[model samples]
Target: MLLETSIGAVIRYKSPVSSKEPEFLILKNRRGSWGFPQGHKEHGESELETLKREVREETGIQFLEIMSFIGTIRYSYMKLNGIRSHKEVKFYFATTPIRDIVISYEHASYRWVSFLSGLNFLAHRQLKSILIKGHRTGLY
Candidate 1:
């Protein structure tokens, strides 16, 4: 099986209204699956570099404050060519003050949702776990 690695961010923004919970940004891809901004790593690029680039490219949010490395999620899936591949995704806990999103062509839409809403938007258990971990860290 082939192995692939990806980098992504669990980007959150605290609402200006103190009573509201911090919201996370999730993107809906052309395929209609909702997920954090992520992409395969490129040669010669550091993990942080890939994270920032992918987030910027996907969301057009330029002022990203990457707080820390959250954790990794691993899984396997069958490729289009019928080959099985294992993949690992590294997620960072990041923050952004800007909420005006200009989603890239790769995505169909985007939403800034509360933590619980994020879990509802994401179907993958791994992704939900990542969000829970990030919330527990309280780093942002």
Candidate 2:
């Protein structure tokens, strides 16, 4: 048996020099499924640092602040060789989107979607709930 863990954020921000509200950038994975930018936390990296780096690698934006801690979700599955494995993921609420944008090939595509559209884009119910709650709070 083995265990793995990751940290990421529902990062949001508005384009500078614009009057529009904040928007979130969600990535479509290699499998082309839409979701938040997240990846495994690397060794010797702080939680915030990992969050910052992972988001950058996936979406090319830098986080400005970690607004809130969104707790953790744990799940288990079998590895490729039939080994058992479990993972715990911690999410934080952060705002980014200041820099110019580009999508890395780690995902097939990306979108700067609105709060509601993000819910529609993401497939996971728990992740959707987090986005809805964040939208209601008007925190971007």
Candidate 3:
């Protein structure tokens, strides 16, 4: 079995004129599944560094303020080579003012949605729970 670790941000931003809460930025992968902007960690990189690089690479937004470390999620999946792999992802609460996003080729689309809408858009139970926790803790 192989273990991999990654880092990501639960990115949120406030609308200037809207009275609603800050919206979260979610990305839709080529497979049509929606989730946060994340990727695998590179060599000699810290978790925060990995998150910053991944977010910039995936979203094309460079400015961000990391608020807090949300938590970590773990799961297992089978690799293409018939190897079982365990993956761990550490998530951070981050904020940005840029609304327009330019996604990388890896994602099919992007959305800046409210907390509830984001929860509804996400298909993974673990990700939904992470959003719930971030909401309950008032990280947004």
Give the runs in model 3 whose Cα sits over 4 Å from its true position.
none
lDDT by residue (tens digit), candidate 2, 1-140: 78898887887764675678567878888886888877898999988898888887877775467888776777788988999899877888887656456778788887778787887899987778778777677655
Q: In model 2, state the lDDT of residue 18.
A: 68
Estimate the overall C-alpha local distance difference test score of candidate 2. 0.78
Best by lDDT: 3
Q: By TM-score, who's the top model here?
A: 3
TM-score of candidate 2 relative to the true fold: 0.83
Best-to-worst TM-score order: 3, 1, 2
List runs of model 2 lying over 4 Å from the truth: 17-19, 136-138
Clashes of 3: 0
User: What clash pairs does model 1 have?
Assistant: none
Instruction: Give the per-residue lDDT of model 1 (tens digit) for 1-140.
Output: 89999999999875578677788999999998899999989999999999989998999989898889999999999999999999999999988888999999999999999888998999899999999998888754
How good is model 3 by TM-score? 0.96
Q: Distance from true position, residue 87, model 1, in Å?
A: 0.6
Of 1 and 3, the candidate ranking higher by TM-score: 3
Error of 2 at 136 (Å): 4.7
